[model samples]
Structure formats: C-alpha cells, structure tokens
Target: MATAKQPVTAPTVISVDDFLAGNPDERRRADAGRLRAIMGELTGEPAVMWGPSIVGFGSYHYTYESGRSGDAPLVGFSPRKQNLVLYLTGGGLEERDDALLARLGPHRAGQGCIYLRRLDDVDESVLRQLIERTVQVHRGVDGGSGR
Candidate 1:
C-alpha cells in the first residue's frame, strides 16, 4: 500500500483581516490590504489564506519533469519585515516584462517574485499592467498552455 502524499502548502481558514492584523503591524497592514484588493480584482478570484502567511487569489496546478505536482496561487502577495513580496510567474514573457519593469520604478525581481519596500515607490498603473500580463500568460490567454 502507498501512503498519500501531503502538500507543503494549502489554503488556511485564516481571514485576510485576521492575518493582516496578526502578522504585520498597522503600517504594513495598510499595504497588504491594498495588494489583497488589487490581486483579488485582477485575478477575479476570492481571497484565501494560503499556508500561514500568503494571501492568495486563484490557483493552478503545476507538474514538474520529475512528476512532482502541486497547486499554487495564480498571483499573491506577502508582507515581510524587509519588503512586501509579489508572487508572479512572469509566464516566460520577457520582452514585455523588461519594458514594464523599466518603467515600474524601483524594485527587485527574483524568481517568480518581485520585492518592494513600499507600494508608493512604484507606479500603480504599471504594476497593474504587469500583474494583468502575468495572469493572462499563466492562464493561457497568451495562446500557450497554462503555465
């Protein structure tokens, strides 16, 4: 008999309000709240507490070459002590991404994520476009299989 595999992360019952109040201070809560609203609208998915910290919207199943697979949020954000992190796959669309980031103001990009110290530092409209593109590409709206 084989045992069932367990996922490392899954949605939790924690509400966005509680999570924000519990985790970050009042200052960070404002920022996280802003992201939650933005992501919720853009993904057209209700907010759910992912794992313990990440407030996620939408979900997609991912399979690796090694056969490992799991579901992850389509787009999410987490407020950290150092920086608020934006979870984005980028959908391998670099040319468009490069152009957007250039005008996105100051930020740091990492694998499938963007870190920002403050939301006020970036252009709101540009950020919206970037997120919209990421969702589109990941959802196959860009004419490829869902990433």
Candidate 2:
C-alpha cells in the first residue's frame, strides 16, 4: 500500500500540442505525432503534461527513501531535441534486459529514462513490450502499476 506522489509542478504547460508548437524542427514535430500515436495505442490513456516539458500518459505515485514523493507517468514518451525519451520504472536499462535493449536499437539509459535518436531507430514492437513489462514490474512492486 504505497501512497501516490503529488506533482511538484502544476500541469500548466504539459500539452503535446504546445510542446510540438514550440519546437521549430519539423522532424521533431513529426516525431511527436508518432510518439503520441504509439503512446495512445499502448496506454489507451491520453497524454498529459507532467511538468512544463514532459508529455505524460497514465500516472503512478512513488515515495523515495528520502521521503520525497512525486507522481510520474505510468508510461510515456517525449521527443527531445537530441533524442526521444521513454520513461519506465526499471532502474534505467538494467543489465539483465540487455537482450531487450539490443532489440531497441541504438540507445542509452539514465536513471529511468531511455534515450533514443528517434522513433525509427527503434522497433515499436520492442518498445511496446518493454513499456508493458516495465509497467507490470512497477505495479507489482509499487502496488499501483496502473495496468
């Protein structure tokens, strides 16, 4: 029974439309659309702005050891200027998932975010499975996987 974390920032600037509108790169704009479509198909929940920059989908709350609690997307993707960011519950591309990562194409991980050059670089099928498995793991541990 874990309590959900509250958002640190308000959901003011958290729209995919606004994010794409502000991005001048046409490629990034297109990437955003693709991410939106994929995320929609995966979560069946519409995306929402997590902070001023992140476009999040469903949500789950977590409290860290420091007693800091915050709400994060159940699963979501973002098209950054340099890469496409995929957030998951795993501890950032765990070594055990190397086989899975190999299928994802060229990418790196940090904390809990998976960074990619673009959607096309990675197979969406692998991405979808990764996301689903990650959600299941998080829900199993956090007691609120949002599946």
Candidate 3:
C-alpha cells in the first residue's frame, strides 16, 4: 500500500576512468583528469562519480532543520563543456577567507560552488587551499570521518 522511499544517498557508481571516457572532447577530458588528480590528492579519497557528471571525493551526511537528510560529497568537480564546477561543501564561501579567493584567478562562486572556465584560468595553489579548507571543515562537522 505504501510506496518505497527513494534512497537519499547518491551512490558512487561510475569509475573515474569510465566517467572520463564519457567525455568525448579531448580538452574536457584533460580538464577532468586534472580535477580528478587535484581532488583525489586533497581529500585523500578515491574519486567516485556522483550521478552522471560530478566526480566526487569524500562524502558526509547532513540533515536539515526540517528533518530531511542526505549524504553528499565533501568536495567534487564536474568538467562541463562551458566550465568546470567545483563543489565546496561544509561552510559556504562567505565563511572562507577573501584573500585566498582573490588570488584564485578568474572564477565565480555560488552558494558552495566555484566555477572556472579552465584549469589555467585559476591559481592551482589557491584552489588547493579552498578544497583543503572545505574538506577539513566538513570532516570536523561530521566528526572527522567520511562515509
């Protein structure tokens, strides 16, 4: 009589290589590779595909004040044709230092995401700091361990 509830967690299914292969454009593929390497090294976790596009690293569980809850990647990136979307969770951009972001080259931030047209468009060191700080904050919020 009751319908089954859909799973809240987006399981990591597609492998990094397989997902990268799905990108037909050579440049996009190369960008995905760079993102994979950067995120993998920052989170110290294996790269996992979230849904069809996002390549996520570590994951954490979150519950809203309204009671809905779900697990999401601590940090991730998607090699979209138009731009690279970086997912920086835990604390939003306002919580992060402004100087680091200023040095991050030409990019835009929305809520908890950073968008870049290309890897060369941003400073890698600043990007690394952003990812590291995001992961650390989320890990602390989730008790220092990812699911």
Candidate 4:
C-alpha cells in the first residue's frame, strides 16, 4: 500500500491581535500595524497568521516541477528584530517592480521578499504599488485561486 502524502502548508493559527500584542517593543508593534493595513488594503483580504510569526493576506496553492506542493500567502509580512520582512508570492519582482522599489527608498530585496527597517524608512505609496502588483501577478498565475 502507498503511504498518504503529507500536506506542506503550515497551520494557519495565531490571531492578528495576539501576534501584534505579543510584540514587546512598541516600535515593532506599530510597524506590524502599518504592514497589516497595507497588505489588507492591497489584497482586499483580511490578514491571517501563518505559522507563529507571519501575518498573511491571501493564499495560493503552488506545485513545484519536482511535484512538491504547498499553499502560501499571496502577500505577507513579519515584524522581526532586525527588519520588517515582506513576502511577495509568484516569484521575484519584475522590471516595473524594480522601478517601484527604486523609488521605495531604503530597503533590501530578496527573491520574493522586501525588507524594511521601519515604515518611515520607505515611501508608503510605492510600497502599496509593489504589493498591488504582487497580488495581481500571483492572482493571474493561478486564476485567483487563493482562499
């Protein structure tokens, strides 16, 4: 008999209030609030906690070429000690995204993540554009299959 395949998605536990309240530092807490509002507005979805730290807005199912599959947020963020990490789904930023990031001010960009030391460190409008584009890209990728 074949063994049942295990799900790869992390349990969506932890409430947004609890997570924000749990932050000991006021600055980080405030930053989390800013991120939550931005992501919520961009995705037009309520924020949901993914795992223990990440606050995710929307979700999508993804399958790798190797057949490994999992569900993940279309956009999300985590307020960490060093920085606020923004997670953008559907892969890295495109050319237009790079232009927006250029105007976004002080920050770091990774494969699909954008890191900001504080909300004031960047242009909020540009950040919103980036998130909006990310949501559009991912939604188009899977036909808005997110929950």
**TM-scores of all predicted structures:** 0.88, 0.80, 0.85, 0.85
RMSD of each: 2.1, 4.8, 3.1, 3.2
Query: What TM-score does model 4 achieve against the real structure?
Result: 0.85
Candidate with more favorable, higher lDDT: 1 or 4: 1
Per-residue lDDT of model 2, residues 84-109, tens digit only: 78887645355645678788888888
The ten-residue window of minimal lDDT in model 4 covers: 138-147
Q: Which pairs clash (backbone N, Cα, C closer than 3 Å) in model 4? A: none
Q: Residues 1-147, candidate 3: write the lDDT tens digits.
A: 999687543756668798788888888888889889888888899888788778888788777667777878889888888888988854447455478888999988877788888888788998998888788877885343322
lDDT of 4 by residue, 12-81 (tens): 7668899888988899899999889879987889988888888888877777767777878889998988
Q: Ranking by lDDT, best first?
A: 1, 4, 3, 2
Model 3 whole-model lDDT (C-alpha atoms) = 0.79
Q: Tell me the RMSD of model 2 versus the true structure.
A: 4.8
Q: What C-alpha lDDT values do all the predictions have?
A: 0.81, 0.72, 0.79, 0.80
Tell me the lDDT of model 2 at 139: 56
- lDDT score, residue 12, model 2? 51
Q: Which residue pairs clash within candidate 1?
A: none
Segments in model 4 whose C-alpha atoms lie over 4 Å from true places: 1-9, 94-96, 141-147
